[model samples]
Target: MSRVLVVEDESAIAELISINLRHAGYEVTIAATSDQAQFEVDRVLPDLVVLDWMLPGQSGLALAKRWRSTARTRELPVIMLTARAEEADKIAGLDAGADDYLVKPFSTNELLARIRAVLRRKAPEALDALVDVGGLKLDPATRRVTRDDREVRIGPTEFRLLHFFMTHPERVHSRAQLLDRVWGDHVFIEERTVDVHVKRLREALEPVNCARMIETVRGAGYRLTQQVQALSN
Candidate 1:
């Protein structure tokens, strides 16, 4: 069963959501405060988080930002729930890395639907399967990237980005597609951020000389091709 964490200060609403989620075949946990929510996440990372905007202490926006910056929780799928009902608030949540947003007074059916949609979108690339490309091997089981027995020191996000590229190599992926598939479908991060990470990923692969495998398709996006271009000494 998929695990879901619901963070909301309202007891009645929390219970209602938990009941609905449980009935829909989800294992549910509830946190009444931002601190408690963080504690719950630290204890057990859920498959998805349902976060309410108005928390007692830190607030859901802060919590979302914290989660996004943490390597362990960077890719945790989140659907933000809010009473603000403003487009700007929704944008803020997405900018903080929420995978989706729902305004207050939402139907349980809609909530459940959003949860299912986010999970479906994130499931495939979230696997722990190993990926290999262009003589560079990445083992998710070990969380290691190596070539010719030499290890590549990679940050978690870069590792994920590289894994996505390797899994779908030889094809150009537009920045929007990369963000959806690699960074979660609903982030409001700029496309330029993708360029930065791609540059960093190349830098990380430099020692192995595997950097050239990632090609910048001008006016398009990027492609991880099996064909390698010559590298400068």
Candidate 2:
């Protein structure tokens, strides 16, 4: 059974989450404070965390930041719950390392849907351990990249960046979107950092002659194209 930790300072809110999670056949643990939540996380690493944005003593954002900094919990899935529904607040939550965000007054059905989506995305799947698009082939299991069967070595961060692009091919992604999708929403890295990773990814692809696969759209952001565009002579 999947285990979930619901970290909310409000008792009623916590009960609501616990009840729904139990109804969904999940083992639920409740933590009313950030410190207790951390302790629970240490004692029993949950499959996912449903964290409130606001909490006494330490806020949910702080807890999410802490989790991202710790090696053990860095990859843990988190869905942030917040009463703040403004765009800025959502961005802030995402920037703090949340995998997803739930605004206040959100329906139980939507909350459950978000939880399932996050878990599904994180779950291991039986896929082609290696996916080839254009000349680039990426192995999800080994995290190895190859071009035309020639092995290419890339840093962990760059590998993740490339993997995300390959899996989500043809879609133009803003730096913020890429950051949230590839680096987890709770990461506090600057949006400009995405540019740095893209540069490194391009450099790695240069030797393989696949560097043109990553396209930058002026005024927009970046995308990975399967069809290699021919340059005019």
Candidate 3:
């Protein structure tokens, strides 16, 4: 059974979510504050976290940022719940590294679906096994990437972006497609944000001279090429 952490300040809402998740055959843990949530996360790493935007002490956005900075919970999927329905609020949540966002008064079915999707993406699967493109190797199990015989250190987002490109090599993918495939469909982020991460990914690959592997298609999108190009003399 997948383990989930529910971080909400309201005792009633927390209990409601916990009971519903438990009924859905998931192991659930509830924390009423950011400090408690962090402690629970350290004690037992959850497959997914349902975080409330408003908390007593530290806000959920701050907690999410903390998780992104911590190596152990960096890649852990998080779903942010907030009463704020503005586009700015959604963008802020996504920018803070939330895997998904849910506004208040959300349906139980929708919440359950979001939880399942996030957990499915995070769950260890065969697709996450080692993948090799040309001489480059990406091992999701070890969260390591290597070119030839050398190891490469990449940021969490960059790693996911590279994995997506490698798995779908030779095909042009639009920014929207990349966002859906990598950031999850439930995540609301600017399409331009994809450009930012692509730049970061290229920077990570620069030391290995593999930066050119990601090709920009002008107005279209991006493509991953394994064929080496000749240097202009």
What lDDT score belongs to each candidate, Candidate 1 first? 0.87, 0.84, 0.85
lDDT of 3 by residue, 1-233 (tens): 56789999999888999999999999889999999999998765677899999999999999999999975577778999999999999999999999999999888789999998887776555267777766678998899998867888799999999998876555578898898988997576999999999999988887777888888989989987675523300
Which candidate tops lDDT? 1
Model 2 pairs whose backbones collide = 94-185, 96-186, 97-185, 97-186, 97-187, 98-186
| Every candidate's CA RMSD | 15.3, 16.5, 16.0
lDDT order, best first, reads 1, 3, 2
> Between candidates 1 and 3, which one is better according to TM-score?
1
Q: Estimate the lDDT of model 3.
A: 0.85
Best-fitting candidate, measured by TM-score? 1
TM-score of each candidate structure, all chains considered together: 0.58, 0.55, 0.56
Name every residue pair that clashes in candidate 1: none
- Which regions of candidate 1 fall more than 4 Å away from where they truly are? 128-233
The per-residue C-alpha lDDT of model 1 at residue 110 equals 97
Model 2, C-alpha of 90: deviation from truth (Å): 0.4
- lDDT tens per residue, model 1, 1-233: 67899999999999999999999999899999999999988766778999999999899999999999985577789999999877888899999999999998999999998999999898777477666665688998899999889999999989889988876556578898888888996577888989999999999999988888988999999988766634422
